[model samples]
Target: MTLSYRVLIALLTPLIFIYLWVRGARAPEYRKRWSERLALQTVPVQARDGIVIHCVSVGETVAARGLIEDILRSYPQLPVTLTAMTPTAAELAQKLFADRVYHYYLPIDTRGAMARFIEKFAPRCVLILETELWPNLLAEAKRHGAQVMLVNARLSAKSLRSYQRFSWLLGPIWSALDLVICQHVDSERRFQQLGVARERTVVRGNLKFDCQVPAATTRAAKQWRTELARPILVAASTHQGEDAIILDAFARLIQAVPELLLIIVPRHPERFREVTSAAQQRFSTLTRSSGQTVSASDQVLIGDTMGELLFWYAAADIAFVGGSLIPRGGHNPLEPIATKTPIISGRHVFNFQPLFDRLTDVNGVRLVDDAEQLAEQCLQLLQQPVQGQTMAAVASEEFAAEHGATARVLADIQGLFPPPNGQARTLKMILTSNPNAATEIWFDDNLATAVSDDYFAPSFWRQKGQIIGSATGRASAWFIQHQPQNMLLRHYYRGGLVGKFNRDRFAREAIVKSRAMAEFSLLLQLRELGLPVPQPIAARYQRAPIWGYRADILVAVIADSQDVFKLLLQRSLTAAEWQSVGATIRQLHQAGVYHSDLNCHNIMLDQAGKVWLVDFDKCGFRTEGEWQQANLQRLLRSLLKEQGKAEQSQQLFHWQQTTDWPHLLQGYEQA
Candidate 1:
């Protein structure tokens, strides 16, 4: 080759490598940091069907430990593999299952990741500890001929509502499962409602009940018990924004029972420093049990260690489980119960309802409504040791009766992990015929058309802005089909593409059009229901600015009708319209749908002077008194926005007496 060409190649080689390095660094961080370690799973050959057990985290791993030992004892020749998602759980499994079972981190839920994982381990059966339902993981497992089952499954009511919203995504995943061994009847019923076949779902009481409480080290327990020389209250698994509430409660109990000792354990060990600082600031004398030394002067003791909750429970007079009192679902209360400690908890216990309900039914657990209540309950228990021990006895009895579910669950596992019968059915997925064709059709645009320019390019955004038009009014409309690489727009119609207007602002222009369409449609639907609402002619789902997911409703602008708040300010509406608005609010409240937002913007008026309501996103099943009070407060806010609070409050009180709530009561009764 020529000298110039040779020199050029030499210079560009290093540049190419640099360019590749930069590009690779810019790529999304796909591979997890610990994934490589997980990839070191040993493949078993000439082994019995692989026993794959999935435990979500530490608690689950601990619960499954007994079951794992049982499974191994039953079939020592069977190769066993354990998997966990969290790094903490993986480390815990490594320590517990070391040299016994193959341990690995679960792959990400992408089809490629799951495919690689299943291909490597070749597990005959997969047992998910709880409700770890990933769509791609389940689908690929079933596709690759692995039997799947959900063991120790528990579904809450709130979880039920969330799953209902995504039934489309969950339906196929549930179908892939061979069986679901739920924890309670309520959980089973919820799963059945979501289309999991009733026959496939079985109620196996919680494995936590079967967990053998770690025997307390006699020397250690004796030393701590002597050091305290008083009754101890153990607050286990406390979360952020909860320590203060628990501390306040503990302080109150301390006043009543002077010999009370408080031991607080936060959920995450990483927050040890922060919690220690807070404890020191709150209590005059605080002791951190990090080392072997145990001090007697310590007013509040902070549990900064790990895997010692059971030991602490064994050393306690009563247990107060955290992550409750606040809005968060409470942590597991089963440990305390199994330890035979009288349990006290806040209202939020959705996560451990079955155990909590059983404890409450037998008067073994105390329900504390707030911080004060929690402290009061703790004080009552400590002052009355006899009563506390009685409660603890009930807890022990309830837990003992619910044991032995692990064996029943193991019996069910054989059905899913069966021997190979014949060749497995194979089905190839056909994503597309044309390799370059756009896959996701959002409205009508092919996202590929926008590939030349980057997403944030000034020129691209300028063009996009122009296509959307000015935000003030309706400008233009376009169909956008988005792909991973780019976005595409289709300009022509199916029959005759006649309308051709602004070229620059198609994306910005769709929102006003969509909102107008939604508003109009809502009005039309309301009119059909014979409810008072503005008249509407047309409606459409706007498919531009927000990737076509949000459709705006539009209605004709009322000529003379004003919003009730605006009318009230001008004194424009007759007494009849005001009465109608109040009556309509009552009617809606009685109908079991409360306007959760309860804003005046939601209330509309027509030219004929009729009142209407909009926005169903925040609506929910609420009490009639709450809805009425909320709506009244909303009206007062709107009036205060226009006029002062004095004017709003004056009119509010006047209307309260002038307007007959009894007439509105009649409208609500009629509805």
Candidate 2:
């Protein structure tokens, strides 16, 4: 007891002091941003032929415990695991089941852990208790073939009201659940209002009833009743501001029942000191169940320990649940009912609503609107033991009748096993920056794949498939269907801007028309003469525009050739190779197709070193003067951009004039 209280004090002392200090201190401006500290390490676990259950906290775990145990017993051959997000819940689960069930801390819901965990635990079925629906978890689970179900579900009215605020993000996630077993009709209705389809949801009653009430729990209550000299009124699960309300009510009640003793239990154990301090300040005489005594003038008594709540209920004449008076969802009233104790709760009984409604329907519980009414109700109940006993008896009967929901849920799940025959083909489409830099294929059920960061650069792939390359940003190349298919995917800004200067205002419409005109005109002229050029199979210029409206161009692959630049840059060219290369260029220019901004990288070479003009988006008519000079200048600029020396480039220009250029002009003028 000392160690627990000390631990509580150690945990809460700083929080209380910090709260007080901050309240009095000048505060900094509030910023609307997520702090980096909030990130969680989410890990995914793979469960092959195993049942994976997620229960958030103590209450959900307790309710789901029976169902988990039943599955283990029924399917002895199958493996099962449980995951919890909180330390206390994990500790409780560990203590409850020990080594009987596999227990692990649930990783934060993040892309990395989620993918890895799914790969680790290829669960056959995933049972999520209550309303702990996380978006990434749900989506990943569905992607990995795990059938998901929410069992023993209950959505409070307050929670439902809050869900309405985020319905857009919440709706699709809720819809993803394959099945939801609600604890009450009201809970089912609330879920439906939040967009949970009725077809997927069914009411299975609260599983808490299915749990066997401990014998010693009842005996301890009897012992408490025998030990208390005065009539005891229990204020259970009270919040911070609520203890004062309970004290105000108790002050009034003590006037009527002079021997009245107030037993106050806080909702969170960490608040024990704050509650006890308040109690000490209010009462002249107070006593704790741990044997600390106070004078009769004292009005408040703190029941701060856990695993003693049942004993407190047994010792009390009437129980008032907290949070209801303060607008927070009322704490569980079932605890008091399970011990055959009469209950008086405030109007905000949203938490244990279904149980409260059942109790009210059977005259098993009393509801008070405020502190005054609570005091009056407690006075009346304490004065008349017969009335309290009758109500307590009714509550016990209702608790017993509501049992078996766990068994029903388990039985239904049993029939859902052995999934339909036949497996479908796995086809995955991943949206990533670059396909070349990827380490491994993202073909896992969880879609756990990564792309390389290097593919995000701009200038590296603008030129390809030609001996003379064009540095027209408007025409770029990429791998399509994972092959080197030159495409004008994103022309200028969108694709059709003619100059780098006009990139800011590039239009998709102009790009499409220009690309089609250039490619088609070249194709028609080349095919007429029966010269070598890639046959244009199909073309699309007015489809799928980018930032601007420019559309991308795609073409089919041509076979049996090496790009001329790759062939020529490596070795000495033969006479036949030189003839074919020079002849192709002459035929193209004579055919009135002069490639604007042509550099060596733009031409393709067959095994025989035959050259072909490609990347027609920058090709222009072979007219005299500045248009021809501009094309030559653009070609020189591209060569310089590749770090070619001014002297070698001058030699390439000299070759263009004396050899290839004159030959091309002779061939063209003669033709």
Candidate 3:
């Protein structure tokens, strides 16, 4: 799925570039900030744990306002990064949120870009408003342990038909979503058909209906309206073809009401100048961008500003939402409801059909087909203020009825992380394979990728220190410093006759329970049993042909520690130091943890006089007492092996000349 999608996106990038170039010519905003679109901004995306909310444009951004506030109030300590896809929406997000969040332009939905985006943000959960379902974005987000959700989600029938054509591609993507909060039952059913589990799909009311009109914007609207004559009519978010219909209707309405003023606000910034140029040719026009004082003689005003949609809705007595006038579905209808402004739209509001139905039922929205019908409705609404006021009030009431969803949304999000022992909860992940690759992994869910043999590569760590290589050809290890502590990364290998032919591969029997995993488990058990040991960070293995395998494990390096073998050659061991070694071994045997290859090199003592055991490859738990004596015999043989090879010195306790074994035995037997 990723490869297929990548190829399509790659092939279409040139066309996409051309589209952006054409739009950039009209709207410099699109071209001026290329770094933001590519996620190359200087500011860091995010860090620590928090939620990220993605809103596609101004309409969806407004709908997410209440939900964002809810999340902030609930989890005050967590960081928030709000992202937008377009410049207008990004600007509006800053105005609405101010310093409340870290804001950015959402990156292009390619795997590399998405991976970098996810890595930078490191978000614990991601909330996407409405239906911005980018497959690679979701997949990469899940790979990094983000719980993705679609809020105020709706799947239009048109979208459903299109998505069905790529069911195989989309099904897995839909299944990866942690939650789908839909606006209606129809959308919920549609999502279920597209492979969303029923348990994860929820029916939540439209958040747009729950939005409130800003008091500051309303006050500004009143101040702006004082300069204009009575009976102001606004054609808000007018699309290209719809502007012609609106201008025609306004031309007729002006003759019937001489005091009326028409306002045309194009939906996009690029069209502002185009609409302004076209409107100025026939009408006495005033534009917000020109900073001209309004006059009763001025027939039309072009709304060429930003972050003032609600202000325009509040400034007028009636509004015709634009896209409906043409076949372009429709813009959000609920924008005017918050301001108690009457709405007039065309019959083709398929994008907001369900919302239009509810408004029509309450007699709050009037629908018209052509310019003449639109003029007629505007004339009547202006003539009968009482009827128009009643409709506006109902629209605001309809908005209030959907008010409680924010709290409900907050509740469900809170349920995702319950406060337990005053710790931030981590996601639970079971052992699972990467479907895109050929490997398996087990770890805490937050990591971006499964820990595997290749994970030990120096590139994986942020800083790989010096790699110390041993003279022996049996095995290899690297030293690196990651967060929290330094780590030792070692690849497992066999020695002696078996190693000559097999090299790096371990026996096939250990495939199910690989040598690395066995050692990792043994270390965990030893630590749990109160034995001193290095922390086992992660372990993994890759299979070879014939089921043979190579394995690796990363363990925290103990600070200020040296092996007993090195310490022995430095000075003659005191009786207390020898006794401490015995007690350490006694503790391991008493806890039923057996070290299969314990020797002088495997035991270490820190500067503060703490003893630790290391290297548990091919080691595990045992119930019998027979292995205890055998382990001691093995250690005795290892000591003699080292003694025969080393040159004797009076400063060291040579195994041939000392009673060190009797002292060790004395401490072991007494304990």
* Clash count of each predicted structure: 37, 30, 0
Model 3 scores a C-alpha lDDT of 0.76
TM-scores of the models, in the order given: 0.53, 0.49, 0.64
Per-residue error at 480 for model 3, in Å?
Answer: 25
TM-score between candidate 2 and the true structure? 0.49
Candidate 1, residue 656: how far the Cα is off, in Å: 99
Q: Can you tell me which runs of candidate 1 are displaced by over 4 Å?
A: 1-32, 36-49, 94-99, 156-161, 189-199, 216-228, 252-260, 284-289, 369-371, 415-671
- Model 2 lDDT at residue 382: 83
Error of 1 at 209 (Å): 2.6
Task: State the lDDT at 634 in candidate 2.
Answer: 61
Q: Which ten residues in a row have the lowest lDDT in candidate 3?
A: 421-430
Summarize candidate 3's per-residue lDDT along 398-458 as a digit string, tens digits. 6676777777776777777532222332211123343233344443233224555445575
Q: Which tens-of-lDDT digit does each residue in 136-182 have in candidate 2?
A: 56767777667888888888888888888765543367767888889
Write one digit per residue (lDDT tens) for candidate 1, span 144-253. Answer: 56688998998888888998886644444677888999999999999898888988999988787786664543356657888768788888888888888887886777
